[model samples]
Target: MTETKEWFESWFDSPYHGMLYQRRDEHEASAFIDKLFAWLQPAAASSVLDIACGDGRHAAYMKNYVHEVIGIDLSEQRIQKAQKLAKENLAFYKQDMRNVFRLNYFDYAFNFFTSFGYFQHYRDNVIAADSFAKSLKPGGRLMIDYMNVDRVKDQLVAEEVVEVEGICFNIHRKSENGKIIKTIQFKDASGKPYSFEEVVSEFRLPDFKELFERCGLQLITTFGDYELNPFNVEVSPRLIMIFEKH
Candidate 1:
């Protein structure tokens, strides 16, 4: 837990941070969010909660469909950006999602784009899951979008480098103990570099199913991708799981 916290906080102070909702990946993110909302079918009056909601892109998108939206992230800078773009009934908070939070307030909750599984200790993941469960109203639904470990393993790219917005980044990945550990190095235009390694621990399908059950939720659906395709060993690029509080 300490390692994960330090790694994330280091990036929180940098401008080249919060890859999830930052503008660089907006198109891909919006496509995924469209599919998520279509499947969830949230009502206009439903209150939605987004855990680890980076820059609150999904929460902003949800404003068109829901009565209220709340996004929470650990990075204060990202939350401030979210708040600046907030509209009526949309808000953002900066807080650790693994602690006891204001309870039973949301009609639906979502954690998208492999946002879960950063904890160094297994108990930390459990604590975060419990916090998510407690944040929802009875019978509320939760959606978690994560990389399909099974599929990612099949297509593991040992190392790759790419340039986005004139910033060079390198990605290295390996699979161990049914988990993927990735190291990302970001270099500014001037060639100054900073690297962070993240271990996404024990996040295969069966592991997540067990966690959901232990948190008092029933698995409702598991899809291979954001498009809601049936999961198959050779076909899926992502894992999208839906759960309902029992």
Candidate 2:
């Protein structure tokens, strides 16, 4: 867990990281984000903070809906690309989500694309939650998009491979306790492999309810997908949680 940051930094700097998103199905991702924002429906005057905002795709898309959008990620390369592509209403910053940077400033905070999990230490996660809480104004909204752990566990595949933009990736998953341990290995055109492992903490409905309560947030809504559909153990591919500061 302690090595997670090193792993991410290395992985992000590798050629595979840039190529990975370039090859992703943009149509699907765009649809997914569109539905997500529709559900969020941020006020036009609201300021948004996007944590781990990879490449700022969501921030760029969100610019039309919000007054200002700030996207932060730990990867400098990703932030650089994001800065290059961002609109006037959107800005990208390189920062660790766990550390406190400034005061209460945002009306809404978003952690999308399963970006909440990764820290080796539970305290790190809590620190991040605290930072998020402190960053938001009173009654600010928080939207978290994470993997549907139960669904993923039940449908777990030992190994899978996908190819996009001339790059290939092999993904593997193993479940232990309430966590899914994932390894993504990327292969370039020459077949060289670069890999990273991520441990995702699994939380059930009650678990999230408790976690949010402990973090001084109230769960406003839960959806199985970006479409705002009711969530159940069997159907949804994602666990979208909407919370409000207490």
Q: Which ten residues in a row have the lowest lDDT in candidate 1?
A: 16-25
- The true-versus-predicted C-alpha distance at residue 47 of model 1, in Å, is 0.6
Model 1 agreement with the true structure over 148-189: per-residue lDDT tens digits: 777778888999986767776788989877568878888666
Q: lDDT per model, in order?
A: 0.81, 0.80
Q: Residue 116 in model 1: shift from native, Å?
A: 0.1
The numbered model that scores best in lDDT is 1
The TM-scores, one per candidate, come to 0.89, 0.88
Candidate 1 Cα misplacement greater than 4 A, ranges: 1-4, 18-25, 186-191
